[model samples]
Target: MMDCQRCGQRNVLEIDHVLPDGTEVKFFFCHTCEEKWWDRDGVQIDLTEVLDIVRRHRE
Candidate 1:
């Protein structure tokens, strides 16, 4: 049901990060979008850093 934020296409949906990774991050993407943008834009964030941020925010 999700659509691409850029193109508004339902065929492909991906998690897009506004920032580059230093940390584990995963985003969902449909095949078409993945093919187009994965290499150019998407980088996986570190899981530990993400968790640490979440923990700190909770505290």
Candidate 2:
């Protein structure tokens, strides 16, 4: 099973991109973490933008 790279949680429900242009590199994250960090963290950059950024990065 995969776990979150940040919190090390095993409830990962989505994949996260570490780079722009929809790269393949990513990490797993749970719904809670996605709302807290992914939505607010400066890492995401665009707030309104939503891409296959989640599914495309899945391992």
Candidate 3:
């Protein structure tokens, strides 16, 4: 059970996915605070980093 960092809520939804380039990622969404974040290889990544991943995969 993952807890929300902002609100300390345990109602965090997680989605594990693989990008087109075979990069694995985990997307986390907090129901309490409505916070969303992404993790790659167990490291938290920012939105800009996520966009970069998408662009790299598309290219």
Give lDDT per model, in order: 0.49, 0.47, 0.89
Tell me the TM-score of model 1. 0.31
Candidate 1 on 1-59: residue-level lDDT in tens?
Answer: 65555566777655544323332344556655553333223454454655566676667
Per-residue lDDT of model 3, residues 1-59, tens digit only? 89998899999999998876788899999999999998999899887887887898788
Deviating ranges (above 4 Å) for candidate 1: 1-13, 16-44
What's the lDDT for residue 53 in model 2? 53
Output the better candidate (1/2) by lDDT.
1
Model 3: how far residue 33 lies from native, Å: 0.8
How well does each candidate superpose onto the true structure, as a TM-score?
0.31, 0.30, 0.89
List candidate 2 segments past 4 Å from native: 14-27, 35-59
lDDT of 3 at 13: 99
Clashing pairs in 2: none
Model 2: C-alpha RMSD to truth? 8.7
Say what the RMSD of model 1 is.
8.9
Better of 1 and 3 by TM-score: 3
Pairing residues by index, what is the TM-score of model 2?
Answer: 0.30
- Give lDDT tens digits, candidate 2, residues 21-54: 4443433356546533243242443433434554
Q: Residue 38 in model 2: shift from native, Å?
A: 13
